[model samples]
Target: MTFKEAAYFILKREKRPMTAREIVEIALKEKLIKTSSKSPDRDLAIQIYDDIRLNGENSPFVKVGRGLFGLREFYEQKREETVGEVQHLIRRLEETQYRSNSPSEFEEVLKEAFSFLGFETELKGEPGNTDVVLKAKIGRDESYTVNVDGKTSRSGKISDVQIDWLSLEDHREKTKANFIVVVGPDFSKGNVEKRAQKSGVVLLKVKDLIELLKEHARYPFNLLELKRLFETPGNADYVVEEIIRSHRDRTNFLENLKLIVEEMENLQSLLGYFSVDSLVARTELGPQMIKSVIDLLNSPLIKAVEEVSEGKYVLVIPKRELSKLFGRLASACEQEKEQKEQDDVKNKLVKNELTKDELIKYLSRTERVPTVLREILLPLCLKHGVVSREMIKEELVVRKMAQNLGQAGLVLSTVSKAIGENELLESIISYDKLKPWKKDNFRLKEEYKEMVHAVIEELKGKEQPKTDLKNRLVEYLSRTERVPTVLREILFPLCLKYDVVSREMVKKELVLRKMAKDLGQAGLVLSTVSAVIGRDELLGAIIMYDKPKPWKKDNFRLKEEYKGLVQEVIEELKEIKGNLQHGT
Candidate 1:
């Protein structure tokens, strides 16, 4: 018999977990198998692992621990307890979906899905009221409810003939739901789909809903953001795709950040500075971000990147501690992961987790911006166009999310993450933090204000929430001019002399000019001042120059694409320098 066969025999007899080595030895001694293979234990372990992973539940072999194995039958005897879990409800759904008359059970499953999706649900009478009422809280005060109806078919297909369209509307009116949804296994082509579209009811397929739930478990959506799905009309597939896109973006971000933190910490450079471009080119993991995006990471919350000169930056925390800090920050910036369960169902997702040690080890390396925070700040950011750390902190505290200053500060730490989320829409159109080194004011680029307002318009749909209209933000873009001393005194002199500036250069200038009180604050204000004059983009080009210390590069390389934007801005900046020289 083969080693795998022998192991099955040995395991059945042992009735306990055994390491691959122990199993191989027992099989050989008993003469259950003969192997000429040099590493029989290794071979057996691979076979067992492949069998379990490949065959899934069908595989008799079960992994016990590192290099250990157990029988599936052994564990099946002792089932684990759960806390009103969604997985079991889904399985129950699978069973109920096939039965023609089990509409009630299907309704129950849909209710479970709503709960799992973090909605406040109520299951009511079938003939009279809607099957389910789903209330979702958008912010601390804003909330809206959805009407849900489940359709079941023995043939696993639902046609318009099977549903009461007028009755569904009646249920919607009676229930007073902001929106109505009809969910079923399948729908008839012409009438069912046409009526759903014509009447504005969402016909959500069971399989599609299940897929959304699985994706939700993997990358839990902020309830406020998830509400976007209900507000959107048309196929349920659209909602599924929306959630899928969000999940992919977040997963990509976490992994990239982890990489940067780990890589920068490794250098441990004496000067403790590196170019962003060279770093991205070498690591091949940097996301497409503007230079001022540096300000986000440089914020008090993350403190991951410190932009010293034009395009140079240093990691504030080393690799070992960075991983731990990320774990804590990711947990703090968690986006509504409370109701979702971490399950590994064969076809389902394994839930988005940022705490894994290998940095997860550098995935979301840059920042961990929670979706909830993005939702909270969306309208506020759009209206003001210029915000302070205090304003953001006050918003979070008033939202009743974080209690007091400390908790509010924890929530605010994810502001770097917020920058990331909004930046994906349009890099320059989003936040350009002017003072990341301090808890101070920052503004958006004036040129991109209109485009940003359009993006904001898209996020906030036609249907307005019924919450109090207290925060009716202004229609016009607003920013009082802010020209800090660092912009004129410290940064300009160095910028004129050097194509590529170092953190050291700016620090010395700050000390010489007596613009900053101390070296510590001087270091903080380096690239920060340039961000105000919108020269941060030039620094992005310079970021690519560093190729590690041995081949250390100091020359500023302006990338082809950024050349035009940089030249135009530099001309305007030179005018600023001229004004300074003229004492006007």
Candidate 2:
């Protein structure tokens, strides 16, 4: 490798500032290249150093001095460097560009990079004093504003304070969503940490930024996590414990993880959705205790939960899913508590099993994903078929109630009767211990069974695999079998109003699909209509399709209604495409 390439490799791997002599010694010990103190190649190394220090935009090597080189861009402008002078320069530059009526190469490159990151950005006004404003869409009603400061690197001098210095709170308020990343090689980890702590800001050093571009482009760098890591004097331990150690100690953690796996095997047969959470709650533990026991559900374990949803979660011996793993862990915990009373050896074994070090290592090495619990819920829809998001929410309430009861362990007659009544929210769940509503089949009132059946039949009919777009859609609409009532009310009308054309077609299609399914190896050709019409729209249309207040409804229906207004989105797309087609 060239000296520059060798330097980049060493620094990137070391991930710390190092002196030139230190780097040379290590490189020589490893026999990485043919070099000598007396050789002329030492002159070549000097030239390599100059190449990196200059032309930084084109160089992969960022020189942080004292012979250190990193692969990152390490410079950004200070905010106050140019209010009047810079503003004037910006205006003049803008005027020159307007006279030419063309974007300069630098402006084009900057614009492209910003656009790639989902920004609507503009270079307005002028040169040294010009402003770069970026508009970013956050969510429905939130848009973020970014102001890019313009400055250049200076060897040893820091920028001077200007018209106003931002107070810690003010700085935090102003740059809450924005970042003050030190984008050059010379930035120190200690400096980055100090600024971040004082302002509750996120500081991405040059090397980290380069690594981010290479690896986690889509994964938003958690500003909050970074702030916490940098702000608190010792919070770095959280990063080490939560991320680094979890990776380093994977082997030992995985062994304890096996305990959870065993628990799942034992619990899967006896549980449904209620097992995982119920087992956790049964320890009489609060959130902190649960977090402590699980080493705060490290990122790797979170990703593992996602694997279960994706069908890649390690399958245990027949009928034992990964959810059982949590159950098994809880069982281990319980078993440990019990054994503590009788077997000292067993107690020590448990103590040594899942130490903080091992847990951290395992989690760090594993994949990182979000909303693992939510992902786990997705698989349930496949098994239960008709559990709508609404029904899932309702089930959660019941599950939570069940968990509370399970934790109590004593079945007081009054509380037992309350549990029997089945009045609870769907979100209150521990899926493993979830009890089926025992009063009637499918939780449908007896009088609504016929209506439910009609809806199911309508859904079944739409399952035909016809090529006619309209017919296939109608078939899909009518064919959605095992649909919960909340979904049914929304879907049935949309099918009836938009696709069915007549009730006879619905009946014929429904019966035909059901009969086809009854025959061995038959499959209905159905597509997801709601895929085209979103969940929000489907939910909203259902209310218009039927009249009763939903069995279990949430006020978030307002959000759903807003989302369902995708029909209005047609215009926005049309406007853009039309403008593009006309070369506007």
Candidate 3:
């Protein structure tokens, strides 16, 4: 294993923090890590430090002090104990002679305190500037620099005017340090505590620093934790505790979702079409908590809830319908295979004189031919009469078949042979220097079109009557209850008059002129229809052309299947209009 993996394994096994040197020593002795670096110990140390710096609290290693490390949980517990001990020392020193020192002596005492607390101290001697600069590691991932200004008073109270010129903000602007601390006898006048709060400046009592120095002298402590106590707002212990609580809450939420899914096959089925309030009450969950859980279960992949009405839902499983679909697909595959075998025999009989019917049969039997290609080739042959080999290649590339010219040529060569063998195309010109061979002028024979039309009618006889687009729209509107009653009355007549409706028509006629509410309710109604009946199916029912330029003044007309339903809605609207005129 590498140094990082080896160090993590050892730390996890020991259940304690180990310094880089100690970790390397143990890993080498136990044959845990394989490395050829001459300075393996230094390499390991650098790796551990980088991991801690990059991953922060998520890192397995936590810095205990300068050059000391431990497991994260152990470090957290030890940190609290150290901070509490320092707080006690601060209280003790507040009542001593430590507060009655001169300014220079006070600076010396603060310097000593920081030095003992694992900080590298530098005294900055200049007029109207910070007194001392202290650098310390905050955690495995963080290091910080702080500027300290010393203030002394024999009365045990330092006035705000003495330190007003040395605001944390100005000092930070000049020095670009992470934090600024003011070490003084005490800030007891001019609302110093409130000032400190507003400016984010750390206020340290002279006695507090002396006590911390004395405590460190007696017993080593984690200076990082002490730094956090001074820098972090509010109780640092509570902040750390909340971090742990949040992590636990996240883990529990995920586990709860997994357990709930296993216990309830369809959670919404318990109470069909219920609201968010009912879910919370039934599950005994926190009022704000059930929404996220319900949303997770309602995702499209899970399909846990079917929205039967707005703000109300029911559970449904599509397994039975899915099974039926699979069965139909399997039957279709068998039919395609049988049809292919029959076409092979038919092709053998008319190999030289291929009719349009035979060509359609060949196309229908061919698997994986892109729909766009079929649409392009069939129309061009029927209209243009003649098509060149080069033209075919160009069209194929334009349709994104192959990436470039060379690849398109390769694909076309393969497809050309298939077309020629089926007798749908005949070569008229031989290959030469100027151009490649060309195919004869082609058109779909009348007899062949008649034969295909007959087949379509036979299939239509076996098919069931499809659901009408207008009826689907009405069902969706009824369920959502989103459309205003007056607007609904206007929309029925508009759809009937046009036999279809576009977004522009709905916006101008129904929303702007009739409703006059300055709302985009028409778009919302169309979106609901799209969602309920699928965007593709709804467009297919209303759009006149297969390849529609919707942005180019296109007029959508109802398909033959849906025209009858449009007429029905139109009749209903006429009756309503008659009643209104008669004052019934």
Candidate 4:
């Protein structure tokens, strides 16, 4: 192994900081690393030094003291050092909150604050516009804008200023914003409060905004949670405080996680394995709390526990290893969060450099695909390699995804921005001249077709062999003895949309080699449908006994309110396995 890799193993196993010489000695003694040099310790130290020097904060090795090194993974977990910019910005905001000789200066700081919280901010320079407009986009479809009226007061209270409560709504309407708020150092009682309440405007104090900044700088970045800031028309402090309470609850969960993991480690020695309910009973704790802790242990970063039975779990890793993982949870989470944000900026900067595999992977994963592309366009693309631009609008209308074509176009535009350049967009789809960015006949590039077809099959409920199974086997064995889960999932969604679906319709849908030509397995298919919809109800479904003596059902009808259950089943069946998850 390399010097750095060996050092990492040693540091993680030892769970403590060590000098380079000590690490080298251990590596050599255990044969974790090989080196023929007389001064192997000095060589390892030089390699680590060079790594830290080059990568700086991103290095795997961090200097703890004179010649002492530790894995950066478990180093100081607090985000205080990294949140320097936020700290400085908050200081400037606090200084200017009360009284500002220069309104633009305060506006500039406010803009920085908003931008820091992941909003696109613009100082409305025009006379009629609000002081600032802040826009936030949630995913591809939903977006909201905030018209912020910045008030500066000589008396450190907004009552000193001529606050226009009347134009707030007009300003929101003019700016096409979802919400409008008045931001100041503080507001005097009576008139200011009365006017804001009457205008249905949110009175946001600088201190509350500062509180949000402080919270953002902490371990849990809650910028998205702060959406409640615009949701209610009142003091925004309540929203910020509510978010803080959530973080506090998360803290409690973390403590519970410690208790659960440590207790599970002890119990594994005594009981071998335990279920969530068993753990709850043994500890005399709530099942929900134990289950929630189990969820955390099963997270991607910390896979300390694995389910041995249906609900019973066993500790997968040793207690020391688990402890080592959660030791630096705060810093590790912060680093990962920061890395993703940086990667997003990097993705946008690239001009449609997505590969064929990447395109397929993006569309196949629900999180990666925009809602329009996933729910509307891609489904049609699966049927036709080249779906027309109008087809997308039509599908959106049919599905009620958008109110009008104009809104559909906005949704498409958001998709365009997400997918990147027009060159890339047009390469995939035939485009119209007017809104050429995302509008066009959606088509797959020739290179993307083969892999995309495979993904299309996967989306169409093509199941894999046993190991790719996730409750499919157990559910299938117990619930429907003969019918396959995939066959049922395909028909389930279709059943929800229509009152009466027949065997002939299912046969037509499976025109491909998906089903056999002869109706040998027809009974199994009918049995699967009946098993889901209620077999007792299937007795009524039988129209009559034919002259041949066999009973036949004419149509498939999902009893009312089964739509939600049907959709859930379909989603569970289509849970993508293998490479689709986080690009593997």
Candidate 5:
């Protein structure tokens, strides 16, 4: 474990500041400060501590107050604290010797000490309060927002002087949240400890913070644990060291490391959607944006993966998360590959099977193929030219023949050829042209006559309805001059359910329903419904559908009397207006 790692572990586990002695104890217990056989009783842990403290100022580990060291820079940066201010405070702490006991009334010293630790200090926020808060991110794939009250204590509990506060429940509700740091020398009684235990919030004290700084110099925790130690600088070093040792089984560690790496890479890729560079470099993006990306990469939700390439990473994760992410990626790649193949086919068809003039003149007019299917073939068309088009047609015919053995291929020619015979021979000039014909006897029995006949009949009786309501409607429409609005309320739903309604049907229905006086008014009513209401009601009354519950909200059905009443009112109003105008 590095200094940052040690500091992180302390914060996460102990939830308090740690003393140099306490940190040394933890290091010995965990065997973090290694000793050679020749130097068995030489206090290797203290040596590590001294080294950390010597260069602790402005280093990864920083002294918070007297005898308390913490990974201040790590937490401060995690919480987006001012680097310069933190450096200044650390400098001040190095020079000024404050009492080892309780911090004094001299606010400047307190402010400087906070500054040294990189706390965003606000004086007299709403008055009568001196609150110090520590904020930082923790977690692999989650935003573990921790807040610590800045205070120190002999009881090894966080202080009640909350620099920031949020309920524990709120914190827990967060995708990954831990604590709200209450920064002080000590808490009222065991309030800090109780809350911390109950809410799973860390409590850091001044001394604990100091020791963390010391630990960070030798063996530092990752961003997450480092943040927690600073949040509540208690005797966190021991707790964190124990955690590291207990969990440092080689197999588990390697597995976790792999998982973290993979997750971090995935996170980086997600961030790349916004055009962010890798954590290792400054992209073209602004500094703040880059910082945010780095923050995201280091978040608990995103585990740090090993770098595979420049701006490329593999995630460090277990099989489950990896499986899901890989599955999605694999699916997307397959879809893209499939689409590419389809496009290649189409392009080949265009390039080989059709002449440039033919493609330009007639390809735009072709609409039988769906856009998705055309996309598939576009590349093929581009590649093989006219030959690919023939291939596409042959494939389609083959598929159809496969499905139905008796199926015959359609005359695969343009509209121009169907309408004008001379253009067909001219447009298609090749040795292949004579293959389908036998000179003057080229006129084969028209196979498409049945399809054409069906189309003609369909057009002739387009408005014919199987229901008797249609005939009665037509007769009533012939008698009526004006449409009654009441009929629309009923007809709209019917049109929607049975896709058999038309403009003539609407007019006829109005008369059949006794809602119109004459056919002219029915026509006018149909026109009014089509034009003013924008063809909504007369055509169909379909409730906009959504998944699972299409009819959840909308209820469009109109009662018969209510419809009649509304129409009657409109008629009465019109009559009244006409009479008043005449009288005037």
Candidate 6:
């Protein structure tokens, strides 16, 4: 038989707790087993200890005392009886309200309780200060000190004012102790409990301490173990339970989901919609267990699946979709984290202004102008540009300019000079000013009207075919100014189909051509057409002068001068299509 089996048989036969040496000697005398080791008793003891430690409560041998072993059932019965006796002692102590006792007498009782738990106590506190200072040997070379402040009241309940006398922080600073305990008859209010938690002060009622002392008598705890209770004062038990629950949740739910996904053919197959009942049937897990697994699987870290409808879920495993969501979240988090870093860099730039080359490199890497000082200094460092410090200052003063000629002239001149010198400029256009111009349908000053009329007259005199003329005009306009591309692509086609285009005509064309997928896209196309027509000098000349009524079916029409040119272009396009169809 194995050493484990022999030990178990010996323990059962003895019918009582026995030391390893006694068990080994009795087994050898009875000729139950044989071993050649010089220290047979020690080997047997090590074997028995290994079994009990490995199996825990399920082990055949139970540890009755230091180096003593007995049958499991027998030891359990004795431990239960001891615990019962300790509980009874606690109840008896609780019935005798010790609040009426003198302060000194109560201090003595507390010291005795600590002594029973193997701590050495001293009356180091003054009459009006803490009552006792405790020192305990936690290890062979390590020691811990704790300060205990005692508060006693004639009434059974102790008020918050009385509990405040503990002053945990003051005692900790004065004594430099590892922990502080405040023992009182009872806490009076709920707020006192909250204060104790925040202060890290262990509030032990007189009855509670008596119960702890009684428990120590039954099952003594080591100094290191007792120190843990003092170190984490209030709700330590609840904290430990929560930690254990979190660990269990990760292991059981998250790990199981990973395993389940691994066994599938592909994650995409799971994207098929599934109800809770269907999921339970497919995974072969209990309904409640499956629900918990689903909750954990839906988190951002996993994001393996998401609920699509009521009581239905689908896998969202596409990396593109997940990356978009993660990108926004990550960008926000990075901005918040880097704000302080940016501030530090800004301070350094202000203190030791960078050289021209260093500033260029810094600006290349960073996205925004670091500060107003940097903006004002930038124009001075450039070798060639009309944007002087005064010009930049002027631009800053007029914050919003829909048709501010001075700002516009400054922007154009600076850009022209910068290009001539082959110098890089950050941005020529002010986006804030440009936004209002676009929103107002590109309203321009009266100076621009003559320019628009001249372009219209030039188009009317063109001798080229209308298709070629239209293409040339579009190309020239795009090169000279910012022209919206959608207007050229979608609006020109509709103008060819109908001599004049209406809102309904545009929407129908968009749907038939599949240029837009929904109302939002259609609305965007219309807004682009409006902005482009309002901005282009030639188109503005045609549409602004021939403005149709708001409720008219054909609300947009080419002016009389441009109508013949558009018709010829449509005819030329039709001829090209006919030739392509006939393979000419």
For each candidate in turn, the TM-score is: 0.42, 0.21, 0.26, 0.43, 0.21, 0.26
Once superposed on the true structure, which residue ranges of model 4 sit more than 4 Å away at CA?
1-78, 123-127, 140-142, 221-224, 277-285, 296-304, 319-584
Superposed on all Cα atoms, model 1 deviates from the true structure by an RMSD in Å of 31.8
Off by over 4 Å in 5: 1-140, 152-178, 186-192, 227-584
Superior candidate under lDDT, 1 versus 6: 1
Candidate 5: Cα lDDT at 505:
66
Q: Model 6, range 1-584, lDDT digits (tens) per residue?
A: 66567778888877887766677778788888888853455566666655655565577776564346788866783364345445544553354335343344455456656765679898643444567889987675668888887766777776667665356677777777888887767777687677777887777776667645664654465676566667677534443344334445544664465544442224336655765576565677667776776675588676767887887777666545644666566656755534553344334323322232333333322111322212332332232211243444454455332136565445434433432343222221111111212210111122222222222233335424544656855454344232333444456556645667777667666666677787667766666667667666656654532335542223566665565454544455656558889999
- Candidate 1 lDDT over 350-429, as tens digits, reads 11111111112221121223323334454565677545567777777787656687877776665654444553422332
Please give the distance, in angstroms, between residue 122's alpha carbon in candidate 3 and its true position after superposition: 14
Q: Provide the overall lDDT of each model, using Cα atoms, as 2-decimal numbers.
A: 0.58, 0.36, 0.54, 0.63, 0.39, 0.54
When summed lDDT is taken over every stretch of 10 residues in candidate 4, the lowest stretch is 540-549
> Could you say which candidate leads in TM-score?
4
Displacement of the residue 330 alpha carbon in candidate 6, Å: 61
Q: What digit string (tens of lDDT, one per residue) describes model 5 on residues 73-170?
A: 44442122233334444443332223222222212334444434334443321122333332333335643444332333344434444323344344
Cα displacement (Å) at residue 567, model 4 = 81
Q: Model 3, 1-584: lDDT tens per residue?
A: 88888877887788765666688889999998887863465566556656665565587776554344566755672354356445544553353324332243345445656765778898662445677888876665677788887776767776666666445577777777787777776677456766666777777666555554554544444655555645753112343344334545654665565444332334455654566667555566664566676676588756565667877766454445534554565656655643453354344324322343444444333132322224344445444533445666667788766668788667655655445554443221111111133232223332233233333333344333333445664543333254424324544456546766665665566455545444476555544533433344543454352224432322345555444454554555556668889999
Which number leads on lDDT?
4
Model 6 misplaced regions, further than 4 Å: 1-97, 124-126, 140-142, 165-167, 235-584
Off by over 4 Å in 3: 1-14, 26-38, 46-186, 189-269, 272-274, 282-308, 313-584
The positional error of residue 454 in candidate 2, measured at the CA in angstroms, is 62
